[model samples]
Target: MTVILVTGGNRGIGLAIVQAVGTRVADATVLVGCRSTANAEEPIKELKKLGVPAKLKALEITITDDASIRAAVKVVEENHGKLDVLINNAAAVTLPKSTDLTDVRESWARTLDCVATSQVLVTKAFLPLLRKAEWGRVVMNSSARGSIGRNIALELPPSPHWLYNCSKAALNLATIDFRNAEVRDIPDERDHITFWTVSPGHCKTGFNNFRGVKDPAEGAEVIARLLESKRGEISSATFWEFEEGKFQQVPW
Candidate 1:
């Protein structure tokens, strides 16, 4: 049976991905991560209806504490034994900045912890299980606003929403580093992990709460496609955009 670990899977794109993947991967073990599984009652019920093996793992976002990440990993291991796809999708970005840079630096650090650092930390905690799979996939749900080719090249004014921009930029770099690590650092010529930073585009969910381009179902479907890629057909360390069941190479 295939196993998947998805963060922020209680709502929006997360819920949509769970639902879509349920219909496709019949025997897949889906583990959804949330700050409190108690709040995830509604979605977990919906997943159970799909009649596939599904579990909820608790993960508090405010606590970037490594223990939280490990607890989540422990749940996945106990239930599924191994991890195949890890969707580092739990992300939080504040609304367009309304304050001075100095005042917002602290908040920026918090965003750094969740959006950037947590992605790396959570994956590291679960990587041991990922390596157990002959083919493992790690997808970092990222934003194009973090694109260095676009934003750093003066494409968008750096002053608009500095905090979110910086966080995503850090995430993109981290995704690249994860790809290189998974590919070149494995022992004895065994490397099966393919890492990517993918953009959900303007997904309309509580994260933005209907303030974006596509609905959560539409956006998460893209994530499903990437996760189910055929063996040996790899897309590692790249940034991908979903467009009508096809991919557009988003600038990094």
Candidate 2:
């Protein structure tokens, strides 16, 4: 059975991804990572109702906490020998509601910690398990705001949210660099690991005060597809967008 771990899988788009995988991939094991196991209780119950063969495991993974991350790694090691797929979907935007310029500095620091820096740490901690698997896939749940071309095309300000947009932009570059580095380190194992950065589109989630163009399930379609056992022949190390019921390649 394939072992998949999705960070921030407790609610919203993340929960939708977990549900989709659990319902679709009958033989897969879904480990739902949340800040606390309590947050996963309801989701786990909901997943149980699906009556699929996929097993559920709730792991505590506070994105900005090293101890929490290490504990999650330990749980995965003890339960599953290896992890086949990792979806980095945990992110935070702690900026003030007033949209004040004065709070940008502090907000930027906190945003980068959760949105970008912590993802690198989580991936590093899980690399050993990922390598042990037959084929490992790392998916970065990114945003369209990360795209410079899209921003320019839409005529949005250069720094749309100051922290959130820039952090995602940094994540996009990191995704490319990380993929390239993996290839360089394992030229013979090219088929072993696949990396992708995907935009979930405008989803009506808590991130945007529940105002968006798509539902959480709709936003999670591409991500769930990527995690499925019978996946399509997708190009490795590419960016994707969930649009109009299909996953399309998005230019960085």
Candidate 3:
């Protein structure tokens, strides 16, 4: 069975991703990563009631805490021996309410730490277990608003959440860095691990107070498609999104 772990799987797009994998991916075991196992109970129950085929289990993981991160890795190592997929889906951002420089700085720092730095640290911690699998994949949950290309081309409107965008841009860069380090340079195909970044496209989640246009399930389709695709069918170090019933690459 493919051992898939999705951080922040307790709700919203993360939960939708778990459902997608549970129903769509064959012989899959999904680890729902959350701050507490108790936090995941309701969602797991709901998924089960909906008759999801894959095995679902709660995994306690607090991305901002080092001890929690280490503990999560240990648990997965003991239970699964190897992880086929790791989805870095958990992220937090506090929008600054004022134009004050100090407030902006603090918000920026915290957002970067929560969204980008912690994801890299978590991926690093699980690298050994990922390597133990036949084909390990890491998917970084990013946003289209983080695309520098779109920003430069005037494709997107100005937004107040600059810090969040900046953090996601850093995440995109980290995805490329991991791909270069693990897949590009490694001569042995068996040792190669793929890394990717995905934009879920403004899903209606608590993060945005339900202001987004798409449903969480709609936002999760790209990731499901990526995970289900053959290793050679998709390339690493790429950004992706699902729009208008199809998967497409997003500019960096």
Q: Number of the top candidate by lDDT?
A: 3
The lDDT of each candidate is 0.75, 0.84, 0.94
- TM-score for every candidate vs. truth? 0.87, 0.92, 0.97
Candidate 3 lDDT, tens digit per residue, 130-235? 9999999999999998899998998987887888988999999999999888755789866889898999998899999999999999999999999989987899
Model 2 segments more than 4 A misplaced: 97-102, 155-160, 229-232
- Decoy 2 TM-score against native: 0.92
**Ten residues in sequence with the least summed lDDT for candidate 1:** 54-63
Q: Of the candidates numbered 2 and 3, which has the greater lDDT value? A: 3
Q: Where does candidate 3 stray beyond 4 Å?
A: none
Query: lDDT, candidate 1, residue 53?
Result: 56
Candidate 2 lDDT, 127-240, residue by residue in tens: 899988888888899988888778768754455576888898888888888778877787675455778888998899898899788998888888877765343377677888
How are the candidates ranked when ordered by lDDT, highest leading? 3, 2, 1
lDDT of 1 at 99: 72
Best by TM-score: 3
Error of 3 at 43 (Å): 0.3
What's the count of clashing pairs in each model shown?
1, 0, 0
Query: What's the lDDT for candidate 2?
Result: 0.84
| TM-score (C-alpha, index-matched) for candidate 1 | 0.87
Which residue pairs show collisions in model 3? none
